[model samples]
Target chain A: MEYVIHLAILICIYLILAQAFNLNFGIGYQFNLAHVASYSIGAYTTALLSTELEQGFIVCIIASTLLSALFAVLLGGIATRLKADYFAIGTLAFSFVVSALLINWKSLTRGVLGITGIPRPIIFGRELNENLDFLILIFAFVLLVQVFLYFIFRSPYARSLKAQAEFEHAAMSLAKNAGLVRNLSFLIASGLAGLAGSFFAYYINYIDPSSFSLTEMIFVLTIIVVGKPGSFWGVIAGTVFLVLLPEPLRFIDIPPSILGHMRQLLYALILFSVVWFNKANLFPVQRGV
Target chain B: MSLDILPQLLINSLIAGSIYALASSGLALTYGLLKILNFAHGHLMMVGVYMFFMFNDWFGYEVIGSAIGCIAVIAFIAYLSLKIFVLPFTRYSYVLSFVTTLALSTIFEAWISMQFGVNVKSLTTGFQVHSIEFMGIFITPIQIIIILSSIALLGCLAFFIHYTPYGRRLRAFSQNEYAAQGIGVSKTNTSYVVFIVGALLAAYAGVMVGYETNMQPTMGNAYTIKAFAAMVLGGLGNVWGTVAGSYLLGLVENLSIGLDFWGYSIPAGYKDAFAFMIILFVLLLRPQGLFNSKSRAA
Candidate 1:
């Protein structure tokens, strides 16, 4: 039962992260590879605040989410001005900068020793230390985020994002304010990723630099691509499926050393095949005249 | 910190820049021709170095023979990747190819780690290290060979792109795809040639790096970013610009290591961040890159 609840909590966390990614890559056609960086910023923010300042859950979550969104302003401020192909490269470079800071800023980040004993959230003057309580709290947040995402997906703003993604000039001629929409979407997505990161820290009780590498970005990408990018329900289904797909590996007698890499290899292959076979359907080209 | 180390620093810069040039040229070519950012380019080099290790260090083969075998193996892998992961999406979204190649990189890293136990491995060859002193500067024979090899390979790339018919076809294809097809350039054939050549250059760079430093599965991660930095510093698709950018980067990095201004020096841990800084600054100030003035912004 504990294992099941743990998996449920993980699924909830990834669902929010994937939805955040879905907004940028799936809806806006902006492949911001630094989504994991935002996630890391959130996790690190919560980790530092809770451990150092002894801040409560509300303060940590709010601070983490806002800080991550602030980072998006910096990332999106530069990324929004670049061409499509260059946007990915710029975001990737920004992520590397964040990673470098996380590693080299030894005084602040503890330099890879990683913060431990991160206390779980204390809600309603009660400590929610059990896995079940955390799962329930996380699942509620997931529901709240899903509702927010659903409204955004249904709004006219999302239509503009889709329009701009399909053809920028055409959307611009339609008076869609593509820049505003792009920045808003990026900010929101990163904020949600930050929120998820806070939950991750609270649940795991430890946060490290290794948890948020480019490979983690690839895993989120795999979830969205497999679930069919731009589809709201598909992302949810993907989060559930991918989170559970590797569970059976634990039942096998494989060594722990190779097991982690085996899962990565599996996801990489899955992502490659999905993108390869769905080339025509996914992100259809919009040739300019 | 004195003038005595200037020559040494310059020599070191040249050596580092040569390896970066080898890595980024192939990256520049694919992005130039097909608009495909081969994220796995450095990982391909990683695999090549491992293959070199398997043949030379493990099986006691000669260096030349092992390099040939490495090239052959990487060439095949590059071709297969292009055929399967890259080419089909050239006409489609560029982002798709980018993600696909990113996945390919993950696959390579994971497989290498799984096969070779995540431990750093160095190549063992029979050759002895010998450094020659000229004008108070010392350079090893391997370093000289690496520099010469870079010059020769880059020269050959220039000649091939400028003087060869196939190169003309590639240029034509990149310039205007429909017009090139109308003029009888086969996209499949051109991409095959481009990818194979780029992979070969990367293989050589990987071998050079492995010979110079230790080998690890994630070693390619830094090179991938460095190559991207070089590519962006030189316009993204401009081959010659990438080479110049690589050398500039090498010089700047080495010079920064030697000289400290304002009583501050870059820490060892932050060395990798230098590439990101260059990239971020370049992308912000001049997205078209320094050498290529033509704007590609949409």
Candidate 2:
């Protein structure tokens, strides 16, 4: 039961991550590989504030979201002027810079030792320490984020974001500010990622650079792509499918060391095969409804 | 800094920069010709390093012999893989190819790690620690080889791209793939040759790097970023620009360490931050890079 609840919490965290990434990559058609960097900023912010100042969970979450959104604005301002591929590369460079700062700022981040013993959330005179209680909190957050995303996805602003993604020149001719839409989408996506990161740090009670690597970014990307971006339900289903798929592999008769590796291989193979099978429809940006 | 220490660091930086140039030049070629970012380009280097290690271990080949063997083997494998797997997806969207390459990168890294444990393997010929004296300056032989080989390779590449028929065809293709295809150039064959050559260059760099530092599965990650930075700095799809960008990066990093006049030094880990800052500044102020005349392409 505890293990199931733990998995549930992780699924919720990833759902938030995948959906947030989907907002930009899927809706805005901007491939921001540095999304994880925003997530890391959130995680690190919450971790620092909670550990150093003994701030409550709500304050840390809000601060993380705000800080991450500010960073997104700056990064987006610089990157939105470039093309999609350049934006991806820029974000990747940003991720590297952030990761380096996290690792080398030993005075602040404690370098590689990583922060631990983070206090969990206390709500309404009740301490949520048990796995089931944590699951409920995480699930509620995920639901709230998803609902907000759903409304945004249906908004006129989102329609323009989709239009810009589909054809920037055409959208501009149609009187849409493609750059502004791209920047706004990026900001919202980054803010949500920060929120997710805070929840992740709180749940794990620890945070480190390794948890927000290019590999992790790629995994979230895979989920978004596999789930068929731009569709909210697609992202939710993708999170559940991808997160659950690897679980069954644990039962297979394989060496403990190789088991983890085998799952990675499975992900690679699945990603390749899916991209290949969906090649015709996958690459072209879908028009906003 | 002491004069001796300054010279040593300069030589070291030059050597490292040369290797970075070698690997990144190959990446630039593919990007130039295909307009596709080959994310597996680093894995091609890894395969090269692994082949060199395997040849030396299994066949008792020396470093030079193994380097040649590694280049040949890597080129063939890359050619075959491109022919079999990537060619079929040529008409597909660019993102598909990017994702496929990324997936291939993961598969290759995981496979290598599974085959050889994650421990870093030493490939030194017992001469890595030895230094040669020239004009009262001490330089390692490996460092000398790295610099010399880079110059030679660049010269050869310049010759190939300028003087050879295939090179001319490559240039034409890169200028306009559709036009080249309209003129009866086989896009498939050109892509295969370009990929193979790129892999060969990357493999050669990998062997040299393995000799300089220990080889590990994850080494490719750092090199990938550095190569991308070099590619962007030099102007993507420009070979000469890549070489220039590499030296610029090497000098900046080396000179940063050299400028610690008050006995205060920047930590080595901050080197990447320094590089990132430079890249960000360049991208913001001059997105076209130093040599790039046109606007930035992805």
Candidate 3:
């Protein structure tokens, strides 16, 4: 029962992450690899304040979201100077900067030891200390965020974003500000990613540098890419498929040491094969006029 | 701050520069030709180190023979990776290229972590701890090996790119897309060659670095970023520029590692922050490159 509830909470957490990525990369065509930086910001903020300062969950989550958005705006401002592929590299550099701080700032971040013993949230003077209660809280937030995203992504603003994504010049010729739209998308995506990060910290009761690595960012990237970009339903389906993909392997007789590697190997193979087989549709080339 | 420290810093700087030079040169070639950031290049380097370890450490093969075997394995992996991960999506969208490389990176890193665990591993070079003194300067065997081999390899690369027909084709490909194709440069085959050569250089450096310091799965990310910074410092398209940039990075890094500031010394762990600041300065001041001109094709 506990396992099932835990899985549900995890799915909700990752659902938010995947959607956030979809909004930026899929819709805005902005490749911000520092999404994980925002994630770490949220996790570290929540973990530190709740453990050290005894702050409640609501304050921490709100603080995490706002701070991550602030970071994204700053990163986006500098990154806007770059072209398409260079923007990805720029964000990756920013991500490295964040991770470097997390590793080297021992006095503040505790370095690699990570922060533990995170406290459960007490809302409305009620102590919601159970896993089931956490699951309920996480699901409510996911549902609320999803609805908000659904409406925004389907609006005309998203069309302008797509215009900026596919051809910034054409959009700019029509008086649309590509830079502003990109920054807005970045803020929204990173802010939501931060919320998911806070929920993750609350659920696990711990936060570490390892959790916000390139691998974790790739996992979220894989979810949205494999799910089909720019489609909310596709991302939702992808999240469910991926989060549950490893569940059935518990009954297999593989060695404990190699099992994790094998799963990753399989995931890589699948991702490779899927892209290869569907190359015609996934990547339509633009021939010269 | 003192004359004694100058000799040690120069030696350390050269050693560090050699590794970065190897990596940055590879990055310069690929970025110049393909114009895509191969994010998995670092992970591919990790695979090479592990392959060397499997041969020399686990199977007890001779060190020289193991290095050859490791290069062969990495070349084969590089070939397959290009066909599967790069060729399909590179023409379509930048995001696809980034995603594919990232996916492959995750696979490589995960496999390394699962197989090796979190414990650090060091390559046993079987060298003495005592430094050899020459002309009042001390140098270790590993440092000597690093400097000599890198020079030989880089010299060979320079000769190949400047003289050989295949190298000419690579240069043609780098200068302009349509012009290269117009001049009968085979895009697919040349790209495969580019990927293999780039990865080979990075792997060679990675194996040496693994011998020098601790080897872990996550080491790839830091090296990749540093190599990129070096690539920018030297120039994007020119290989020799990468050489200069790598040494520049090495010198600046070691110089800043424990610098004295008005009778106070800085911490070594802040070296990465220092490296990042150098990157920022390069990007802001000389975004084209410090060593090479902007219009360079190779």
User: Which candidate leads the pack in TM-score?
Assistant: 1
lDDT assessment of candidate 2: 0.83
- What lDDT does each candidate get? 0.90, 0.83, 0.82
lDDT of 2 at A161: 91
- Better candidate number, 2 or 3, judged by TM-score: 2
lDDT of 3 at B154: 94
Task: Provide the RMSD of all predictions against the true structure, rounded to 1 decimal.
Answer: 1.6, 2.2, 2.5
Ranking by lDDT: 1, 2, 3
**DockQ, Cα level, model 1:** 0.79
Cα TM-score of candidate 3: 0.94
Q: List each candidate's DockQ score.
A: 0.79, 0.61, 0.42
Q: Model 1, stretches more than 4 Å misplaced?
A: A287-289, B1-4, B130-138, B296-298
lDDT of 1 by residue, B146-247 (tens): 999999999999998999987998888768888999977888888899989998899889888888778899988889999999999998888999999999
**Residue-wise lDDT of candidate 1 within A1-289, one digit each (tens)?**
9899999999999999999899888999998999999999999999999999999999999999999999999888889877677888899999999999998899999888888999999999989999998888888999999999999999999999988888998999999888888999899999999999999999999988999999999999999999999999999999999999999999999999999999999999999889878888888788576
Error of 3 at A196 (Å): 1.2
Which of candidates 1 and 3 is the stronger one according to lDDT? 1
If candidate 3 were superposed on the true structure by all CA atoms, what would the RMSD be? 2.5
Give per-residue CA lDDT, model 2, range B31-51, as digits (tens): 788777777788788878988
